[model samples]
Each structure stands twice: as structure tokens, then as C-alpha cells.
Target: MPGPTDHGRVLVVDDEPQLLRALRINLRARGFQVATEATGAEALKAAARSAFDVIVLDLGLPDLDGLEVLAGLRGWTAVPVIVLSARTDSSDKVAALDAGADDYVTKPFGMEEFVARLRAAIRRGAASASPEPAIVKAGDVTIDLAGKRVTRAGEPVRLTPTEWGILDLLARNPGRLVGQRELLTSVWGPAYVGQSNYLRVYLASLRRKLEEDPSDPRHLLTEPGMGYRFEPS
Candidate 1:
């Protein structure tokens, strides 16, 4: 409903008083409704009670492990959780991600980087892929534009906002080869159209998730020096 830049709620869960204060001040300054909790139990309760746009979670807690809190939250909520902790080991990061953290930020992080990551996570969490009500069919992939859903060969497919936006744009212009410029502009906005690397990376991910053979894609066809096309089967 509202744009991402508008006011939204954020829950900062950490035992450290200094970090909690800093996050509260910074996030409030950036136009977010901030809530702070000092324990895993309180974090879980807060999650259950209120709708939080993004969660800045610390790995170590006094009562319960942060991983437990992450798992608990993921059980019922897809609320974007960003793990912020001093644990920089690969294992710790992987564990948090595996437990369903949307993003991970290590401690001693730059405020700019932290804010950027937070913005991206929040944008992704709240972004609606579909612009208006319409059903788009491209091969086995059926995108219910209004419903904001995608299904492949009768099986539902879960897509992030960015992935769904890309698919929706391509489906809207079936049979026409949507150039890199148009697709990028349509999905990520004009400011990002020149970032070819972004297109390449996301296309690869989409193909991997949707195509029968990512190497030899059936529906998502890449036009070298051009862009991509969605050919319905």
C-alpha cells in the first residue's frame, strides 16, 4: 500500500544496550517505527504481537540462542530478518541464513552499509510484484498478476519480489523479445537498466528456478546482444 520510504515498523533484538540505542536512533532518523527487545523470548513475543517490516537480530541472547529465535520466527512469519552480530565466521552466517534469515550483517559494520542492507531487505519484503490485476501465461509458467502468485505446470512457485517482477514484465509481452533495457527498466526501474551484471545474475537465478534445464532453457530464452523472451509452450 505505502511506499518503502514511508514509515514502517522495525524490531531490533539485542542484549547490548549500546547497540540497541544506536539502532533505535539511526532507524528512527531514517523514518521507521522502532521497537527494541533485550531477550529472545521478548523478541518472539514482539514478533507475534506486532507486524514488523524488518528485524535486526543479534546472534547471542541471554535466555535462548539467536538461531532458535530465528527458527521460531520463521515458523509463522516471513518477516525479513537481518542477523546483526559479532559472529563473522562462515558457519555462523550460514547457520543464520539456513534458519531463514533474509540477510546477515556482521558487527562493527558501517552504518551506511547497514542502512543500505536494511533498505534493500525492507523494499524486497514489501514490494508488490504485480502492478494491476491480470493473469499472464508464458509457457508452463502461469503468473496470476493480481493475486501476486506464480505457478509452473500446476505446481506453485515461490518467488521473491524481484524475480516475480521480472517474470511479470516478460509475460506481459509474450512473443516479443523484451530487450535488456526494457526488462531492466520495467522491473528494477530506469536507474538500474545500465547495470548489465544485475540482469545477468538475476536471469541466471530465474532460469535455475523455472527452467527444466538451465543450460538449455525452454521458456526463458536469452537473446545474446539483445535481451530475453518468454516463449510459452
Candidate 2:
């Protein structure tokens, strides 16, 4: 097998063989170096052993709660993780994202959509590390979206890639009400315009990184149901 390269390396974790096989095939077809594991323990071991560009994690693992796995991964890794769950409840979705899952997909999803979401998650993650111009800022926080570096009060602040993507998009269009559809489309691509959960997760993360009070955000302002506007003060 070819080694992991600039393209990407992905780990697909699911208890079911068929689902794993399907994901492996699709990810490989999309030019990702693929790795698979059927158990949460195996997934942890694989993650500990290598640096994967992304992880597609199924929420219903046989040995552990998917949230636990996500939390564990969050403890040490910054790898982008997209959750796959059969559950449709908004609470479940919120929990996983709050716990550090970068994105989520319900079961019975189209392959094209799945591929698109995976690509979005990976792209959002990769953007921080990619080369670009200088850093931008609102106040004390300096955000180098291209370099994935954030510093506030002259100290470094870490942001997840998803969070950085949100900040990057808003910074590019300062003081504009980046429509929900427009943000989802611009950040994650056209297929994700309706996936508001992705927006919620990333916005929360961005506020936590750049705001003095995330609950009462200043720079990352919510435009109610419409979308978000980044007002740099």
C-alpha cells in the first residue's frame, strides 16, 4: 500500500464489516490512504500508533460509548473526527460535537453526501496547516487561518480546524451576515448547506477560542436563525 502523504490518511471505525468495507472503498477511491478498525479499542490503538488525517467514527461501537471514544481521542489528538450515528436526536448530535467530533452524519446517508462531508471535515482540518498570507485579528487574538495559529493577550490559543474554518470564513467577510446556507456551503461545500449542526459546533468552538465570554460573543456574533456575522472589534 502507498504510504500516507499530502493527500490524506483516514481511519474508518465501525463495528459492522459491511459499513467499514464500504467506507474503506469510498475513501480509497477518493485518494485517501485508508485504515480500518472494528472496535473502539482497536481504533484507539491505531490512532496511538499513527497520525491519521481524519477519522470517520461510528457512534454505536460494541465495546464503548462513542462519546467516550471521542473524548478519549480529544484528550490527545487534534485529528478531525466525523461521527456516524444511526440516532437522529438533536441532543445526541450536540453531545458528540461538544465532545470534540468535528462533524456528524446520520445513517442511511448517500455515499456522495458522505464523501462530501468527509472531504469537508478533512479540508477544514487541513486548511490551518496550509501555507497562506499573514495572520488577522479582532482584538488581542491573532488568527492565522492558513497557519492554524491563534494567540490572545500575547499568548497562543489553540483552535480546532473546524473552528478555524469558521473564523477564516468570517474574517474574510468581516461584518457581513454570512448566511447559514452560504457559510455551510462555503466552508463545507455545497452539499452541507442544510447541516446546521456543523455550524453550531464550529461556532461554539470559535467563540471559546476568541471570546472573553463565549455565551455573550463579541467577534463571533450569531445572527439568530439566519447565520453568523464576525464583527472584529
Q: Which ten residues in a row have the lowest lDDT in candidate 2?
A: 1-10
TM-score of 2: 0.60
Which pairs clash in the backbone of model 2? none
State residue 2's C-alpha deviation in candidate 2, in Å: 12
lDDT of 2 by residue, 1-233 (tens): 13454357889999989888888887777788899998888999999999887898999999988888987897788688989999999778766765667777999899988888877777766764465446677888787766767789989887766666777878865654556765776678878867988889888877887899999987889866667778777
Q: Report the C-alpha displacement of residue 14, candidate 1, in angstroms.
A: 0.5
Which candidate number would show the highest lDDT if scored against the true structure?
1
Q: Rate the local accuracy (lDDT) of all candidates.
A: 0.80, 0.79
Model 1: lowest-lDDT 10 consecutive positions: 124-133
Top model by TM-score, which number?
2
RMSD of each: 12.3, 10.9
lDDT of candidate 1 over 15-74, digit per residue (tens) = 999989998898889888899999999999999998888898999999999999997997
Which runs in model 1 stand beyond 4 Å of their true positions?
1-5, 128-233
